[model samples]
Target: MAKMKLRVGVIGVGAIADEKHLPNWQELEAEGRVELIGVCDIVSERAHEMAAKYGARVVHTDYKKMLADDKYDIIDVCTQNRHHAPITIASLKAGAHVIVEKPMAMNSAECRAMIQAAETNKRKLMVAQFMRFEPDSEKLKEVIDAGRLGTIYSANATYLRRRGIPGWGKFHIAKESLGGPLIDIGVHVLDLAIWLMGCPKPIAASGKVYRMFGDREDLCNAEWGEPYDRKEFDVEDYASAYVRFERDITLTMEVSWAANIENERSGVSILGDKAGISTSPLGLYGYENRSLTTTRFDWLPPQSGHRMEIRHFTECVERNRPVRVKPEESLRVQQIIDAIYESSRTNAEVPIKAT
Candidate 1:
């Protein structure tokens, strides 16, 4: 006998849906574990294209209409940074669970509001901080759990790219897109490092921000495809932070859209009492393995970060198990991100109010 399939609706059929979420859920549908039902986008054409391409039964341009359409077991939100809170709250109030992308909301306050709604409504809210589902990251988690890294002391997580700003509109320098690479890319490293370190309470944080190659037509670091509003470009292109945890552990994070580095540094390396482990773009490190020490996945997973997270969410809904990445845990990531922004502005160490 087989189990019942979970009905899932995905909101925002944009690049992330077409590229990551839809394809991932499609694979789950193929495996007969979940039923892909609805897809919504602000642009009707995109919704239609995704529904047609993926065989979803329902499609809507308005998110409210989609939320009101049916009592879906899971609503996967793949929208921009600003829209996460409203849509998530509405879905929760409508009695449906939510799975949203990371930097959970525009700020820590929005994150708190969404969590409150979910708690009041008794619905599951899972933020897709997709890195936790990556094979390498999971392996690193296992390594730590096995106590191979014995009493991890410090870590450095980086998401540095050399002039590789995104080639989309507003994502580069638009605050309405909710800040720059710090929230856009830094959130992942911050969450990954903190999670790998047992989600320690971030006690204090200090950050530095710079706009080295920004605010000009000729100095635009991203692609020359979109007509950017030179006057409206007001976000930082580079951000770095230092964090101290309550457990006496510390972590350093560096993220950037455009930098002078030779290449990208997209990994987290934790130095422990016994050994050191590092991973990037692939599997985890088993620094204590006799033959495979200090080397994590030599090859990458065949799936994307969004895939693993979606699968975990769907399965958690099906089994009534806890969301692998809890809303509270994800909210902590947003909390740190907010602090980084504040610390950058004040040029002082900002204390994290929430544990």
Candidate 2:
């Protein structure tokens, strides 16, 4: 009959599982669907060098002993942000089907206990929000799901990196990346500006965070990697927020790794009464014949939003179908990053409670 394959497994072989989920799960294990078996890492030589560079027959430094030794259908967590809810709730109670990485945990009560351990183990819980698998965010989410961006509201998420303070790993260590650049790269442009405004339900947030230049010591990061310890730089190189969603939808965020910005900038811009979009030069702003138009994107297909977000979560777990990054929309982007870090620790305005 020739069907069954999907056995994959991986749990933090670092640097985003060596640059984006083990080279796209070794290209879906050379297209015979899947079967990387295992690879974990508390650096047992980076879990045997990423399980001998991704062929992955097995190697773990205890992800609860690789979930009590094998039996995965799929579990690629790329860990950090505090072991994404206890290794995705112990790999969904050891039955697998998880895809963490993102600001999906370390808040929102661990994203509601990793979505209640993937809904009491029915499994499938994705959240690698790779900017919604960007090709200019899937052409502005197909022109805002074809209503042409009408009635959306507002957005503006920016990611700045003028001094790029990521001197490799544990990103300035707020107990291992819980905050900084608003949960790293501000949870990727605030989860791509709240999934391009169609996921609205954030309720509230107002923020502030800054540490100037990564706890300085004559700072000059010299190209981001290996030079960390300025007393282990306690997080927050910059962050700013203002979110509110559900019907009246609004968002405004700014992230940074170190600022005084002028060099690296990131995008996300939405605002629709009828049209408005922007994701770094892939634009559209409207008023068609009443005359204030602007649309761009001369050509698009250059895909690799982390290899189409690990090939759309391995084709929605091989066609059981339904995971375009939803874990209740990453627990509403981790409840607006736990209400912008409890509104930057009680400066006020925090509300957000809508899992």
Candidate 3:
């Protein structure tokens, strides 16, 4: 006897789908492990185009209609931030495992709802936090889990781009994206750092946000390749936050889409009692015999983050195993994000309640 090929459907055939999700599904299809059954987008043309290119047999403008097909074993929700919760919840109720894009949802409340829906339907819900699948990130997780960086106490995660405001999508709109680079890009490093730290429970957050350069046409660069309305850009261009966890562990994060900095830079540094680890040049720093030293691996296995994420989700669904990026972990990430936004608005520290 042979196993039936897993049937997969993707909603939101936009940049992320075109660039990452669809391509990876095509690879899985080529390997005879899964079938791309349908592609859906509000834009009919985009959906049909992706279906034609990616071997999906059906195209739909509405995701609900696609879900009614009941042929799909997995649904990939690549929709906007606001739609993550509804689409995921609905997909789970429709009896399909879900893999939604990062940040989980606009707020923690929505994350809780999505989690409940998954539980009610007995379907797996996974957040597509691709950074966790990257080569350097995997190596760092291996080291940290091995107790190499003993008793991790604090971490700093920063991702900054001098003039990298996204030109496409509704990233600058508060309703669409929830925030600027903090929610957009900051979520990546923040989730990575938290996951690497064994997901300590976040107790509180203090943060601030600034709208320094997003709305300035003169400051925004065309390198992102889209003409966005300067007047419509109303989200923060920079954000900084400090979070405390249950075990007295702490994490600090800073991220920007447009900052008047020396250069674009991004990195994460985790400090433990014995040693510390950093990414993007990926090194370990510690004291050896009362002398400071650094350790750098000569090579790490090259893996596509997006591909690994898609493959992992599909395998989890097929094998009845747990997903790497669990929904509860994503909820924790969302809780921190919610606290940061609340702290920024109140001009005071906001306490996070772990549910």
Candidate 4:
């Protein structure tokens, strides 16, 4: 007479888990749609604390133990970039759908492996690309799908923080997080931009990275988080890339955790032959009646993209329908990231092999 509740487990009870993933999943638990079964983290105290706070039935320091201990219907992974692939693959093989944090994994190879595991397991896998769930993004996508912005050719994604390197986590450590803002905040805007542009196949990328202020000793880093050792900061704070896609489509991206700028600026702009659109002000620009005109939204629903993203994943899992953020699409984004890093290393354009 009643529906069964989906059991959910969460890995990596860190800041992102606490702030975004856990709170939203807990809300779903309250709605009787899902049960928070287990919370896992390397730090046992954090695991126990989140388990108690979120009404999870169990706590685990090791994710393997968590997978062995219970059969979860869904596993939300909020781990570091390097652990995304392994944890997600393991969770999928263990008979649970997975939703991992953005940037997917450390490299394209890992992304492909994760996708394969999901395919083999017949489970859903989704990336938490929260920006795509925003109201403005949804509206813009509708306009684009309707051919309002005809023949989309190029786009630009920019995310720059004046002096905002993470002072807290393993973000500055290259071995732990892969790279700096490119893989960090850069991935967010880049993924959103490409998704809005209809996800063209990226052919090649040319890029460069710079470790400007992150590794320095004399900079003010008090605003971000707790202070960390300067010697541990080895990743690039800034990255720039130009990516070429199929059908001559192109995208240029610039991201920095620290830079010399008037203020922090972040937005994605899509250019088309007929018209153009920008995300910051949610506006469209083009010529109307032989005169330039701009249409700006005076109001849009202010919904939390993270909450919407979590709900979307849960609904897709429940209905056994396709997820909004498909693994193949995320793999493409990972491919672009890999090419950019390789291009930076060789100081030449790197081709993105088809996967």
lDDT of 2 by residue, 234-258 (tens): 8788888888887888888888877
Per-residue lDDT tens digits for candidate 1, residues 1-355, read 7887778898888887788888888999999987888999988998999999999999899989887777787888888888889999998998888999776988888988999999999889998888888777887888788887788889998999877666654575454567888888888887888888888887788888887765656764544343566567688889888988887899998988878888777888887877777775444444444565445456655666777788888878777889888788888788788788788888889999774
C-alpha lDDT of all candidate models, in order: 0.81, 0.83, 0.90, 0.92
TM-score of each: 0.91, 0.34, 0.98, 0.98
- Backbone clashes in model 4, listed as residue pairs: none
TM-score of candidate 4 relative to the true fold: 0.98
Scored by Cα lDDT, where does model 3 land?
0.90
Q: Candidate 2, overall lDDT? A: 0.83
Model 4, residue 291: distance off in Å is 0.8
Best by lDDT: 4
In candidate 4, how many Å is residue 4 off? 1.0
List candidate 1 segments past 4 Å from native: 1-3, 220-227, 281-303
Worst 10 residues of 2 by lDDT: 219-228
Tens-digit lDDT track of model 3 for 62-99: 88888886567899998888889888988889998999
lDDT of 4 at 3: 79
* Residue-level lDDT for 276 in candidate 2: 88
Poorest 10 consecutive residues by lDDT, candidate 3: 217-226
- lDDT measured at residue 8 in model 2 versus the true structure, 0 to 100: 86
